[model samples]
Target: MGGNGKFSRWKISFHRAPSAAKKEPPQEFLCPISNSLMFDPAIVSSGQTFERACVDICRDLKFAPTLSDGSKPDFSTVIPNLALKKAILGWCSKTGSGHPSPPDNSEIESTIRSLSGSGGTLESPKIRVSEKELLKGVTETPPILLSHAATELNSRDLNLSSSSEESVIANSTPLLPFATRPSCFSYSSSPSTSSEFVAEEGSRNTASINSSSEDENFITKMRSLDVYEQEQAVIQLRKKTRTSEEARAALCSERLLLALKQLLNSRYTALQTNAAAAMVNLSLEKGNKVKIVRAGMVPPLIDILKSGYEESREHAAGAIFSLALEDDNKTAIGVLGALPPLLHELRSGTRRSRHDSALALYHLTLVQSNRAKVIRLGAAAALLGLLKDRDLAARVVLTVCNLAACDEGRAALLDVNAVDCLVGLLRNRAEFSSESTRENCVAALHSLSDRSLRFKGLARDTGAAEVLMDVVKADSERAREKARRILEGLRGPETAEDGEVDWEAVMKGGVTQARHRVGKSSNRNSTEF
Candidate 1:
């Protein structure tokens, strides 16, 4: 039995026959990858058993196999062979050499017997189990055994039953009660009334009953739908998901997100709209945001933004806005060329799409490199076009401020006549406009004022001087002070030596004025624009 392998000691040795008296290890128990008796075995899609570690190694190579038929199976299709794993565990327990301790198998055996006839043959249920029937069938056995039995019985269903050819079909006669069905079993909390005998097994049984009920409901809904009806069903499901946080979280599953990504390419406008809407809600979570972007959702989202229905474009822009929340996603989206489509949305989409697109650009331009990319994509001109939209004015102003943080951005804005737009916003000071929007507009103009005497001359040329004078009398102290400083800076001498209005002193005075407005004398640091 002492072969030259790591698992050599675990092999079962046997003599061929009485006459031959030659020893050979059992082939069925050996793992193909390691060529030794398996300690932890699993099955691949090819129906071959290998040590779990070997399967993982194959997965790392993308499951590329040097096979005789040149067929390569996807690594994702590999599944754990629970029956073989348990058999090995039991064999080790029986030998008392491979296993140090083993769980109780007697309860597992009893649970199996409860589902079988006196002769050990399973009995098919006459009717599907209902909620009341499942609650009545709660067992005292460990859930771990039931989970393994489900896997084992499933394998037996393929091998022993003649009616079905699929390996995963449950046997015609379920080995366990439908209440304890593996497809939907879960662990739940015990009832508050049973404080004395609140066993873990009872809690698990209760959870399994509830889970089976939910599974049945979902199946019934799915079974009743045709192809077109299914699309509508998904739309309704998306609406329901928006109202429940837990449902939104559940939509974050990789399979579901991938499905949504595929649905982005659907010919049906309603399907695409609902899929994008669902993804917008799903991407609210940080992890799901990363997953949605990584699933190649950004490009299709941009496409939807380009030419989808009115509501679809809004949802697509909303999804892009959510994905832009992460710093890494901001770069990923930009690298995927999201800027152009976002700018396109700003220029021509509905008012809501323009607002959401501005928000997406706001986050993306937070990265300094993306600022130049956005300006290059003609964002400066597009933002200038949206400046008049009162509904989108504040976000459009904020995005301009972010882009105008640098000289190149300022130059681009000046080239696109953004100075005229900013001054126009300042001129009216609409009663509906927010204080933040006015502040952002002034901040962008101030950054533009930093470039050169020529650009400052450009501000004055764009009637910025008269607008600043008007803004100087506004109610907000910060707005008044920023306007006065720009007014003085543009009007004062061009050289730095000209007692040129000390910027720090001016900012300190502005903060002082702000504190004075609220009647606070305590000194505080001046906030950066």
Candidate 2:
């Protein structure tokens, strides 16, 4: 709400009006997401503009960031940003900003291919291992993944015994003694062990492929008809992907995600919950987050939120909360109709559901459209209802602060007697452990008071004036500043309704009185002389 000596609602203005007088092109000519002058600016469903290709890639990947107001751009429909595009073209002609040509379709495709790993994304790195470990890996106390990795050295036709293995030394000569590379051959020097070395060398490529094959088989099992097999598959998936970043990355491809998405809608309670839990585990790997959503996991997850089993709903919410943390997944989740159900869970679901749903809402609401949607659905009243218990107060209040940013949110909050609710929390601040609750209480009140005439009376009625003054004197600087802003608004009315002066009447009366005094004085002066 910071403004230039005037009241302004919170808006994310990434661009400014172009003035031909200025030498530089106005910031609005560029796309915020791409940080480049827009050549083909296009508006998506939320009425925000970006480079057209940016939108396409985002949709194809099912990735978008949450905008500031808690809503995300919906790429389902697009309109050419004709006006802005025209202005940008005009400016480019005048200023000659020397902007480079925007990327072409082929370049964009290449980027998509690279990001999705479709275009030469795989690279088989030479596995690094010590000589001792390479020998130890085959005997198998604990399997060494690096040892099992394909060096493909046999394809090079290098008949390396122990001397040649030592000679290669990791593609560099100096680090030979300490570092060794893994491949199809064993690190044996004796001519007698040549067969053993060759056999070991040959197994590396097969082992690596089999390892990859084993992970793919998980998807097939997950989609199996037998319930027990599906259950076991989910269990093994959940257990394996839980701690292994490698496993999550390898297992969370398109087919596996589709299979998991199917299980998310499973009528069986245990399978649904386990699948959801495994999703949460998989999403823990940063690389898998966007890919999971790209595979269309969101719609099924929403199904779980709506009518899944009690235990499953929490996992569903947990998965959503996890995915929402990713910048790209935020929009897809919100756009796919997760917002209202999440708010529903926040209000009436399990303790865990309530917790995760609250968090999901916090991220999803960053876009303006989503904020309005939640407020319209009565989120303000629902959130205020949770404040009755101080135990839930601190956690839920962060989201309350977010809701207070918009006009609808503030109005909705005020309608729900939020001023009174927040003031009461401030009065008993010592009872709560989190200063943030008290801080947020003051902030929500500050936002309410920002441009509201009704807030003055509400604060005066709640004795918010005195409580805020105390905070300004004693609370943290941040809380105190917001308290000061609210207090400033509460100082007094700007003008009195019934206290206007009758200036015209006063002037006429004054002239008549002066003339009467002059006539009386003239008569008296003649006699006195």
Q: Please report, as a residue range, the 10-residue window in candidate 1 with the lowest summed lDDT.
A: 158-167
lDDT of each: 0.54, 0.61
Best by lDDT: 2
All models, RMSD in angstroms: 25.4, 20.9
Structural similarity to truth (TM-score) of each candidate: 0.51, 0.54
For residues 356-386, could you state the per-residue lDDT of candidate 2 as single tens digits? 7776787777777778888888888888888
Task: State the TM-score for model 2.
Answer: 0.54
